[model samples]
Target chain A: MAAIKGFGAYLPEQVLDNAALAAEFGVEPAWILQACGIETRRVAAPEETVVDMAEKAARACLERIGMEAGALGGIIVGTGTPHRQFPGVSASLQQRLGVVGIPAFDIHLASVGGFFALATAVELCERYGPILVVGAERMSQVMAREPRVKESAILFGDGAGACVVAPGEGPVTVLDIKMQSDGTFVDDLSMEFGSTLNMNGRTVILQANRKLRQSLTELLERNKLAATDVNLWLFHQANVNLLKQVGQALGIPEDRVFLNLPRYGNTSAASLFIAATEAQAEGRMNPGHAVMAAFGAGMGWGSALLRVQ
Target chain B: MDIRAAVRKAIQDMAQAPLPADDSASLFTGGVIDSFGLMDLMTNLEEILGVKVPDSELMPSRFETVDKIVAYFQARK
Candidate 1:
C-alpha cells in the first residue's frame, strides 16, 4: 500500500466566460452552456506553458510533503501537450528541479492522464521510492484564437495539479483500477491538430457514457464496495454535461462531484488531481472513507477505489 | 516495399495490427489515431524512416492515413 503524501493544484489567473466566447463566435451563450455545461474556463498567458504550470503545482506538492527535490525517486508528468517534440516535459522538469539523477518521463493519456500517471507512479514507487506525479496541460494554446464560436474551443482550460505518493500501510490505499479501451471508436472525441481541439459531441457522449457506467460498476463490484462507501467522486472534467450525464446514470449525488469546470473548463489531465486537492482542502475526506472514480483521453477510462488516509 | 506500403506497415505495427480498413481518411478527423496512437506512430516513423517528424507536422492532415503518411515521407525524401 502507498499513501498520498501531499497534493497541490494551480489554476491560472485568467478566466473567460461563455458569453465572451459566444459573442466572439456568434453563438448564443445559453446554447453553449446547455450543450457543454461550461460557463467559464481558465486560460494561460503567453508566458505560461504546460511545463510552467506543472512546476508550480509540483512545487506546492513538494512543499506539502516536506521533501526536497533530491529525495524524490521519480517524477512522472502526464500530458499529451509538450513544450516541444523531443526531450519530454518530464525531463525538462527534472532538469529545472536540478534533480539530475532521478528517472523522469512524460505520458500521453490525454484527459485520463492524471489517473494513468498516478497508477504508474504507484508502481514506480513500489519498485523504487516516493514519486512526484504531475498532470499539467495548456489546452488554451490549442484553442482557435480567431474563431470565437467553435464548440470544442469553449470547453477547455489550462492548469496543472500534482501529488506526492510514498509507500506506506496507510488507511488510504489504491485498491483497484479498471481500465477499458475500444479503439474502434477513436474518431468520436479528439483534437484535430497539435494546436486545435476537435470533438464530435454526439459520439464522445455515447462512448464516454457507456464505458464510464460499465467500468465504474465493475470496479466497485470487484472490490466488493458500494457507491455509498465513497466520500468523493473526482471525475475527469472534460464536459460539464458529460459529467452530469455520467453522474446521473451512476446515481452519484451532485455534491459528491467536485466541479471546477465553471472556473477551469476542461484541464484535461489536470482535472482529477485538482478536484481531489479541493476536496482535501475543504476537509471533505477522512480516514476510512473511499474515493471512487474515472478519467483521460483514449478516451481511455479508469475507475479506482481508494481508501482515504 | 514501396513507401506507401512501408508507411502502412509502420502504422499497423504502431497500432499493433494490420492496416485499418479505411487507409485514406484522416486519422485524427476520423478518430482512428488518438494522441497516444499518434505518439506511437511518430516513434515508428522516426525509427523506420530514420527521419524526425517535427512536432509541427503531427497534425491530422499529414498523418490521416497510410497514403498521406507515405506521401509525407516521399516529399521529405
Candidate 2:
C-alpha cells in the first residue's frame, strides 16, 4: 500500500482578484468566475524562481514528517516552469534538499504534471522505498510582460506543493490510477511563444470535459467503487465551468467536489496537492471514505482513486 | 531629454544590473534578463520614460537585447 505521510505548500502573497482582472479586460467578473471557477491567482515575487518555490515546499513536507530530506529514497518535481530548460527542477530540488545521491527527475505535463509526477513516486515506492514528490511552478514568469494575453494574464498564479509517500500497509491507499492523452488536443491548450503557455479556452474546455468524464467513469468502474464511496472529488481546478460540467457528468454531487479555483485560479501542477492539503486540514477526508480525481496540460490527464482514512 | 537618449537611458536602467559593458550583447541570451526581469524594463519605460508600451511589444524577439528595446521605443516615438 502507498500512504501519504505528509504534505505542504506555498501560495504567493498577492492575490489578483477576478473583479480586478475583469475590470482590466473589460469583462464581467461574475461570468468569468462562474465559468472558470477562479476568482484570484497568486503572483510570485521577483526574487522567487521555480526552484525556490519547490525548495520551500520540499522543506515543508520534510518538516511535517519529522524526518530529514536525506531519509528519502528519491525526489521528483513536476513542473513546466524550470529556471533553465536543461537542468530538471527535481535535480535542483534534490540538491537543495541535500539528497545528493538519489534518483531525481522532472516532468512537464502542464496542469497534469502533478498527477504524473505522483504516479511516478508511487512506482518508485513499489520498487524501492519511500519517496518525496514536489509539484511547483513559477508561472507568472510566463505571463506576457505587457498583458498581451489578458485572459491568461489574469488566469495563472505561481506556487508549489510537496507530499511524502511511503510503502506501508494502511486503510488509506492509492487504489488505482488512469492516465490518457491525445496529441491532437495539444493545440487546444498551450503557450505559443517561447514554449510557455497559450490556451484556447473553448477547445481546452471541450476536451477536458470529455476526457475528465470518461476517465472518472473508467477509474470508478475498474476500482469497483461507487460515486457514493468518494467522500471528496478533487478534480483539477481549471475553472468553474469545467468543475460544474465534470461534477454534473459524473453525478458526484457538487458538494463532494473540492474547489478553490475561485481563490487561487489554476496553479497548474500545484492545484491537486494544495487541494489535498486544504481538504485534510478541513477534515473533509475523514476515515472510511474515498477520494477520486484527474487533471493538467499537454492536454494530458490522469485520475487516482484513493481510500480515505 | 532627447527622445533617443531617454530611450537609451531607459534601456540602460532596465538592462541587467552592472550593464553589459557593450550594449550589443543580447540581454536575454547573455543571462542578464529573463521574462520576469523584462517586466521591470517595461515598467521603467512606461513610468519613468513616459512611454506607453502596449501589450504587443512584449514579444521575445523585440526585447531580446538592450539595443532592440531602445530601437523599439525610438520607433514608437
Candidate 3:
C-alpha cells in the first residue's frame, strides 16, 4: 500500500574485528572468518544506546526526502535490545527526533522484526502519510552476559537502519507481504530476562534453512512471479552459509542476493534495512521487483515483494 | 543395497570422512557433523536415498545419529 522513499544507515564507530573476537575465544582469526564468513562488526560505544543510534538513522531517512520530523505520521521501531526494558526504543527515538504523539511502538521479533515493521508500515502509511520505520539494536550489549558461543558469539554487532514509507508510489512500493510463525519451537532460539541468550545451533540452523526457503518459495507462488523474475534478493543478514543454502535450494544464483553480513555480522533486526540500503546505493535496485526474506527467533519468518519506482 | 547401507554411504559422503566403527556411535558429539551438515543431509535425501523429507517430518534430532536416521526412514517406508 506504500512505497519506501529511501533508506538510512548508522553503524557505531568502534570496529570489533575478528582478531579481537578470536583472541577472546582463543581461536585463530582465520578460523573465525572461515567458519562465519565475518571480518569485522560494529560495536556501539559504551555510552551509545539504541535510541542514540536510531536517532542518527531516523534523521538520515527524513533528510533523504527533505522532510521534517513533524511531517511523519508515526514511528515504528523493530528492536530486541532496547536501552531499557521499561520504555521501548520507539518512544525514546520519537523524543530524540523531537516528535510527540504519533503512535510509536516496537516489535520484539528479533531478526525478522525489521521486515515485520516495514510490512506493517506499508498498510499504515495510508493513514500515516509518511511513517518512519527503524531497525536498530545494541546486540553486543545484550549478548555480553551470555555464555560465549563459538558459533554465535561473534555473529552479532551493533547498528541501526531506517526507511521512510509514504502512502503512495515514490521509490519502491511493496506489492505483497506474508508472515508466519509457530510457537511450538519457542525455546529453540530465545533470550530470557536476566538470563543468557539461548540458541540450539543445530536446530536453529536446520530450521532456519527450511523456513527461509519456504518463505521465498511461497511469496513467488502467491505473487504469480518466478524466482528468476526477482531483480534483487535482499534477505536478512543472518549468515552467509544459510543464505547460500536457501539460494541453492531455490536455484537462485548467488549474485542475485545482496549480502553485507561479512562487514557487519548479523545486526539482528537491523540486518534487512542495512543490506537493503547498501543494495540501493550500489545501483542494484533498478526499476523492477525485489524479494526480501527474513527468519529468526520465535522461529518467525516472512517474505515481501517490492516494485522499484 | 539395503536401506541401512545406502543411508550409511549418504552419511559418510555428507560427513566427508570415514564413519565410526559402531553404527550407534554419537555422530554429533564426535564432531562428525554440525547443524549445517544436518541441512545438507536433508537437502540431498532425494538424490542420494530416494527419500523426500517433508517439511513436517524434518526434525534435526531424527537425523542426529546414524541409527536414528535409519529408523526414521525405515519407519516412513
Candidate 4:
C-alpha cells in the first residue's frame, strides 16, 4: 500500500494579525477571534507565487525523505488559486524542482483538493513509482475590499503543504480515500474566474458541517472502523467552531482533533496537509489510525483514512 | 425550562455572553450571534427542546431573535 513517506509545510513569514484586520474593518478583534478562532494568518508577499510556496513545501518533504527531485515519477499540485490560468502550478513546480518531462498536473477542488490529489497519487504510484503531492494556495491575492467579500478575505491565508507518496512502508499507510460533491451548493461559496470570492457564509457553514460529517461517516463505515478508532483527526482548517461541531456530531473526542486554524486561518487546499504535518511535528500523531477530512467550494467534501506505520 | 428561557440559555452558553434582557433584541442584525454561534444554538435547541429542526426550516429569519426562535419552535409543536 502507498504510504506518506514524508510530509512538509511552508507558511509565509509575514503575518496578518487579527488586530490589524479588526482595525481595518472597524470591528472588535475579539469578534474575529470568537467568530472563526483565527488570531493570525500568513500573508504571501507580492512576488511569491503558488509554485514558490509549493516548491518550498515539496523540497522540505523530499529532504525529510532524503530523496532527490530526479527520483520523483510524477507531481500533483492541488490548488484553486493558481498563479497562471494556463500552465498549472504543477508545471512550474516540475520545472523548478528539475523534474521536468514528468507527469505533472493540478486539481482545483478548492479546500478539499489536497485529499483528492493524494488519492490520485496513490493510484498513480502504481504506474509512476513515487509521486510528489503538493497542496498550495495564495488566497491573499484574491482578497477584495468589497463589503460583502470582507468576511471571506478574513478567512483565507496563503500557505502550502506537501507529502511524498511512494511505494514504501512509513509512518502512515493510506487505507482509503472517499470524495463527494453536490453542485447545488456551488453558489454557496465560489469565486468565478478572474473575479474575487463571494460567499453566502451562513449557507456554506450549514452545508460544510453536513457534508463533512457525511463524508467522514462514509469513510469510517467503508473501512469498518468507528470514529473512536481514529487516534488523530486532521480536518481542514476552515473554522474552529465548524470543526468542533463536526467532531461533536461524529462522537469524536475533542482531544483527538488537531487544529491550526487559530494561527493559519483557512489555507484552502493546503489546510489538511498542513495540519497533518504540524500534528506530526507536535508528536500528536502516533502509531495508530488517523483520519483527514475537508469540505470546500464545488460543495466538494472528502475524507481519507490512514494507518500509522 | 420554558422555551424562551431555554433559548436564552443556549445563546448565553454558546456566545459566552448574556443576551439583552429584552426579548425583541435582534440576534442577527445586532451581531449577537455569528454563523458558528447559530449552529451551536441549533444543536443546543434540539437537545433542550427535544425536537429536530428540519433542514428545510433552518433559515436566519426564523431564529432572528430569542422570541422568534421560541415562537417558531412552539408553533411547530
Residue-level error in angstroms, candidate 2, position A102? 0.4
Q: Clashing residue pairs in candidate 4, if any?
A: A171-A309
Q: State the lDDT of candidate 3 residue by residue for A1-309, as single tens digits.
A: 778889999999999999998889999999999988999999999989989999998888788779899988989999878777867999998888888879899987789888888988987989877889999989988778857676678899999999999887778888888888877678888998866788877778888898888888888888898888988999889889889878988988789989899999999999899888889889998889998889888878899999997
Candidate 2 lDDT, A14-129, residue by residue in tens: 77787877787788888667545676788888888888888888788788778787788888888877788777898877877777777888987678888888888877787767
Residue A76, candidate 4: C-alpha displacement in angstroms: 0.9
Q: Candidates' DockQ values?
A: 0.02, 0.01, 0.59, 0.28
Please give the CA lDDT of all the candidate structures: 0.75, 0.73, 0.86, 0.86
Q: Please list, in the order the candidates appear, how each scores on TM-score for chain B only.
A: 0.72, 0.72, 0.80, 0.87
Interface RMSD of each: 11.4, 12.9, 1.7, 2.3
| lDDT (10s digit) by residue, model 1, range A156-208 | 88899999877875535776655666665466556555535556554455456
Better of 2 and 3 by lDDT: 3
Give model 3's docking category.
medium
Name model 3 segments beyond 4 Å from true: B46-57
Q: How do these models rank on DockQ, best leading?
A: 3, 4, 1, 2
* All candidates: TM-score: 0.76, 0.76, 0.94, 0.84
Pitting candidate 2 against candidate 4, the one with the higher lDDT is: 4
- What is the C-alpha local distance difference test score of candidate 1? 0.75
In terms of DockQ, which candidate is stronger, 2 or 3?
A: 3
Which candidate's TM-score is highest?
A: 3
Comparison by DockQ, 1 against 2, better one? 1
Candidate 4, DockQ to 2 decimals?
Answer: 0.28
